[model samples]
Target: MSDPNTADCDSNLHASYYADGMQQVETELVENEQIAQSTYRLRVAAPTIAARAVPGQFVMIRLAGVNAPLIGRALAIYDIVNNDQGDPTWVDLVYLQKGAFTTPCSQSPVGTPVSLWGPLGNGFDPRPCDRLIMAVGGIGQTPMLLLGREANGAQAFGRPNGWAKDVELIYGARNEGLLAGVDDFRQAGFDVQLCTDDGSAGQQALVPAILEQRLQEIGDTASVRVVTCGPEIMMEKVAECCQKHHVDCQVSMETPMACGIGICFSCVAKVKQADGNWDYKRTCVEGPIFDAGKIDWS
Candidate 1:
């Protein structure tokens, strides 16, 4: 078993790295458009953040000088937009418009002053793999687009790009209208397979079932990596699927956070240690992304 003290030290070091790499910025919205049912894509002109951000990282956002919603909301970096010269200029965030913060954010017009900070948390490993399977549910598909583009050689993120020969996305939502950004994934060269609970779109099935079928089709699990986000239960099932297949899996936890930074312990998740014991790890710092096997789904 791993030493719990050693793990704490590592987590502290990781938190320091996050602190050093992040900066707060007061920017303005470039675009905020409704993409799907109750889903909206907000684009912000955060050049510094956009240039530094990689796939799977997220930002904390709030209306500038807003006192009503005291804390910022954490949103994943959906996709980074660039200028004609290929210079990163803005970042896009996709959000479900049900929450208190989101409801207001959706109504905010373009050019609204926004405050945010990030490029925070460890992102998915950009290492090349033979096949990459993205298992996502609900709005979890937000972070997969950029990763897919990087994996397919269409875009480069933090490191050198294009290692996977095949990239597929198995995404599930409550219904067809809620499957946001379907075309975006398709355009990024991902073989997109979609499912819905209500049978409103694609197959009337769950994401994990489709993932299992795809894993069976792939045969060899060695060079495969599965990354998942969205509802915790869904992620747990996806992790279970990966474990059963003996394939590597990474999970983006959706723990609630009062502070997007590591200060608050509100977003801590129980994580297994090398020693076989479990300890709390801050989702905003140590994760938001972690090994599937290490997470204590119980």
Candidate 2:
């Protein structure tokens, strides 16, 4: 198999290379519907951004012609669809209304104009694996939906065989009300295992516990690759579990950013090196996706 880091580095270069050449565009909002408690699915007709988007990549968006929010919000590209001519027609984003920007952004009516830029950051690359396991918690489930869709579609095209034929998603939330898109994932042919802390959903356990148990069940850890995104603590546990099982893992880190193009240096993460060295990498450009083992959990 090729070096995962090399692939990711190449991806980073590509994002930066393209981003430097593309201009931000004003797009029209098509939908802004609440899917779960305080969470919404925002769809926009952004042909340029949509055309360049890759699953796990994101866009920086703000209401067009408005300066009240002051800065754009970095949102994961939840989904992308193409028109008959093979041109991208729409882009989707899933966000939680938790702050000054997201609150009003979520409340914006359909047909409102917004500015968008990207297809930014390195995305997940699930190569050379016999099974792909996705552990998603809270809003971190956003990127996994697209990844699962891609993996499922690839399997149908005879790209991966055996257990890899179906992507397994271990989704967890605080309660049943916070769980979103259970049916959508199932409909997409992913094997979904829903977990909720309050026992109000499919299983009563934290996501990491379920993942640990599942890893033990599989036993052959060498063939499995784990991908996780959520709160830092939860991802730390997932990383530890994958390390213990000798399985490779990747994690998507979430951080506050004023600029999605890596200029502000506000979204930096400490990365651990092979020889016990550490360095900071910008999440907006170098990642949002990174090797779980290389992350400095401390």
lDDT of residue 174 for candidate 1: 96
Q: Give lDDT tens digits, candidate 1, residues 173-239.
A: 9999999999999888899999999999999999998999999998989999999998989999999
Candidate 2, which segments miss by more than 4 Å at Cα?
Answer: 1-23, 84-86, 154-163
TM-score (C-alpha) between model 2 and the true structure: 0.89
Pick by TM-score: which candidate is best? Answer: 1
The sequence of per-residue lDDT tens digits that candidate 2 reaches over residues 40-115 is 9999887877765656778889888887887889888887867799677788888988998889988899998999
lDDT of 1: 0.86
**What is the clash count of model 2?**
0
- TM-score, one value per model: 0.94, 0.89
